[model samples]
Target: MTTPAVLLLIPASSYRTHDFLEAAHALDLEVQVGTDQSQVLAEVVPDRTLVLDFFEAEIALAAIAELHSRHPLSVVLGVDDESVELAAQANQRLRIPHNSPTSVSLTRDKFWMRQCLAKAGLASPGFQRFSVASDPETLRDSIRYPCVLKPTFLAASQGVIRADAPGEFNTAFRSLQELLADPELQKRGGERAKWVLVEDYLPGLEVSLEGVLTDGCLQTLALFDKPDPLTGPTFAETLYVAPSRLPETVQQCVRKAVEQTAQALGLTTGPVHAEARVHQGKVWMLECAARTIGGLCSRMLAFSGGMSLEALILRHALGRDIQTAQTISNACGALMLPVPKDGTLHTIAGWDTVREISGVEAAVQSLPNGTAVRTLPHDARYLGFVLVREKTPAAVETTLREAWTQLQVEID
Candidate 1:
């Protein structure tokens, strides 16, 4: 029997590449990585890494085609948001099982995503798109108070802001304009950089759904509860605890909403990560992406006997049988260590203390000393992540919070 070879599309900066490679090693599968950085090519998978620009899909697909001609790939997977569309396009070209490129593209654009959900009779907030060139004051009359302003293509709350009134909206609009002016962000968003999405704010508990879609059916892996209310002028995710404490009925509603949203968006395969708000027994779909949870958050999940989420995703991509998809009985959670302020990070204290906390699993720092870091609306990367496993969800949340309070970040 020939071993299945898989091609993975990964951003050079993404933290997920290592986890995916670890899973592939365990599965004994031959792996090749496609990235944009030539220097990283030798660092990751050595001779197996192919240099491909994620932003230029046409050129990326052409390079992938040439690579595939030499080594046929049984699976082509995107490791993060930046690579999803490219992976879909490559899959379509190779006739591999994957979500349609059109579907993936729709998910990337917030404006189109809301339009499709609303058209399909799903629960979606009323939203409008504005151009960066439009005068912020002129657009005021069209927007309702207490709404969110977001860049159409940026994710992880990089350009997400909330406005309680027209004045705040004007400020947020201008801030978004400045954010869009960022050369790196502009390069990532392409033409979508010109548009901003404003949506009526949905009030309630915010939760995230992690699942996989196969043959148009959603197999829910886990539902995470955001214990800290996401009510925001600026949204910064802090804690996520799973084996959600919500009532079973509410959980069912969230599941149905996600399933419907995925169907509406025409996502039929691979992992799906979705966010929604539950308000007074009603579910409002916020957004759904054709990829797994972002950052180190996936560390919170583990199958029956400690199988990582990455392993499960790889197993599904290779058409292997999954005996069970249930996470371990013990509750697990992760905290995205918040950046105290925008400045150069001088040092981080309490790593040793936090690691020694009961139930603490790992404490990781993503940035190094003297590295400049900014808070949300301009920066999306977290300082680091803290993982914990406890007997109950509440305990897990408490442990994560307690550990977080002990740490101190010095940004000069």
Candidate 2:
């Protein structure tokens, strides 16, 4: 039997590469990493890595075709937001099973996403898109109070700000304009940087839905209750506890809303991470992505037989039969260790103490000592994640909060 081979379109900064590679190993699949970073090719075994410009779709497709000629690819997958559209395009060109590039594009642009949902009669917030070049004062009268300003493309809450009045809205608009002008954001966002999305803020408790859409049907894997309120001048998500405490009826509503939203967007296959708010018995779809949960948050999920979330995704991609996708019966959660302030990270104290707390699974830091970091509305990266597992959702949430209070981050 010929060994199955897969191509992974990953960015240099992706946190999921190691997990994906490990899953590939478990499945006995030959893995080739396609990246824009030439240095990354050297870090991997020479034959296993393909250097390609992810920003240029045509060039990237040509590179993938060339790689496929040498070793046939059974699946093409994207590890992060930056690569999703590229992967979708590659899959279409290769005649592989995947969602359409157009569908993925709708999800990437915040304005378009809202438009689609609203047209479908789904519960979507009032939204408008404005070019950064436009005069803020001209748009001021149309602005609604208690709204959010967001970069059309950037995720992880970067350049997302809440404005309560005209003064705050103007400040936030200009702040986003400056943020989008940065070379890094411009390179990542391209034309998306030229526009910003303003949407009415939905007041409610937030929850996340992790699921997969196969044959245009949504099968929910987990519903995470964000115990920490996401009310934001800047939304920095903290603890997320799985097996949400919401009543069964509300869970059903969330599931139905996500299913309808995916259908509306024309997303058919692969993993999806969606966020929504529930207030007064109404579910307002915030945003949905045609990718797995970001960062190391997937570590909080596992299947009935101990299959990792990455493994299930790989299995589905490979067309292998997955008997079940149920999350482990034990309650689990994670804390995105908050960045206290903007500055150079001098040190993190009490990691050992935090880890020693009962039910605290692991506390892993992403940034190195002395590296510069910033809080939300200006930055998106979390300092680290603390994962926990307990018998009940409340216990897991409590453990995460207790562990968080024990640690102190000092910045210079």
Candidate 1: misplaced stretches above 4 Å? none
Q: Listing every candidate in turn, what is its Cα RMSD in Å to the true structure after a full C-alpha superposition?
A: 1.0, 1.1
Q: Estimate each model's TM-score.
A: 0.98, 0.98
**For each candidate, what is the lDDT?**
0.90, 0.89
Please estimate how well model 2 matches the true structure, expressed as its whole-model Cα lDDT.
Answer: 0.89
Which candidate number has the best lDDT?
1
Instruction: State candidate 1's TM-score.
Output: 0.98
- Candidate 2 colliding pairs: none
Residues 1-412, model 2: lDDT tens digits: 9999989888888888778888888888888988878686556646688887778889889989988888899989998999999999999999998999999999999999999999999998899999998778788788988999999998888888999988888889998888988998888888998998999988998999999888888889989999888888999888899889999999999999999999999999899999999997999999899999998999888887778888899899888766566887589999998788999999888889988999887888878899898888888888888989899999998899898888799999
Q: Least lDDT summed over 10 consecutive residues: which range in candidate 2?
A: 38-47
